[model samples]
Target: MGKRIRVGMADLNICSAPDSIITLGLGSCVGIILYDRVSKKCGMLHAMLPDSTKIRNNGLRAKFVDTGLEDLLAMLEKEGVRRSSLVAKVAGGATMFNFSSSSEISGIGDRNVDAARECLKKYNISIIAEDTGKDYGRTVEFYPETGKFEIRAVGRDVTFI
Candidate 1:
């Protein structure tokens, strides 16, 4: 058994072997996990929002989907993980907030999913699996060695994402 590492909100982590990264409390936020099975290298990003365009001076660029995905990919590449061999899995993007307004006014979870998918497409990374879109929170765990990820929704069964 390797050491378990906790990745907090608005955090990004890149690991190479013997380490497992976990993230908890994902509501409208999304968790992106990229892993290279051959090298046992993995990277995880917890994005709070879909875009960073509205946030001008947050300084923490990895807190948004667009920028966070970019940074995660870059870090994986720098760690010697090739883009072609990387497999992506994601979890989160739950509509935790209940708003009676239209989708445009309160679809943060949907927007986050869209942004993550677009970012992955832009990077040419294929998403192997995903567990998203609901009205509950989730906790995700990524095992680099086996390239396995588990998602536990607040009121649902534990599933592999």
Candidate 2:
């Protein structure tokens, strides 16, 4: 049997099998899932911040969108997953907090979504599906073998990412 990998907040992981990656509690955060259909390899990242340019420390690298996506892609490449075979799926980036004024905290979710989209485009990876931008949190599951994703959000329907 293949192993099951769980990715926590501000964390990233890559696997070579279906049902190998899962992440939860994405509130104003993003979960990026990359799957290779031919090889059945998968990778998942949970990023809390839109970019890492402001952070000088490496401790929070996984929390940033740019660095997190790069790391996840490199890890998958090391596992013999080719870039051309990778199909992307994303979830989360929900606006969990309500604010009366425009501020960084209030727009974090939107920024995260935009950053993710730009990064994926830069990598030339097409996003096959996504469940993003609401007012709740979400949990995501990826099955690489079939390139299927299951996304569950609070007070909303469970969607196939």
lDDT of 1: 0.86
Give model 1's TM-score versus the native structure.
0.92
Model 1, residue pairs in steric clash: none
Worst 10 residues of 1 by lDDT: 97-106
Put down candidate 2 lDDT per residue, 60-116, tens digits, no spaces.
778998999999889989988899888888888888888989887989998998899
lDDT of 1 by residue, 1-161 (tens): 88888888999988766888999888888899988989999999999888888877667988898888888889988988899998888888888777887576468888888899998888888999988887899989998877889887656788875
Q: Estimate every model's Cα lDDT from 0 to 1.
A: 0.86, 0.85
Clashes of 1: 0
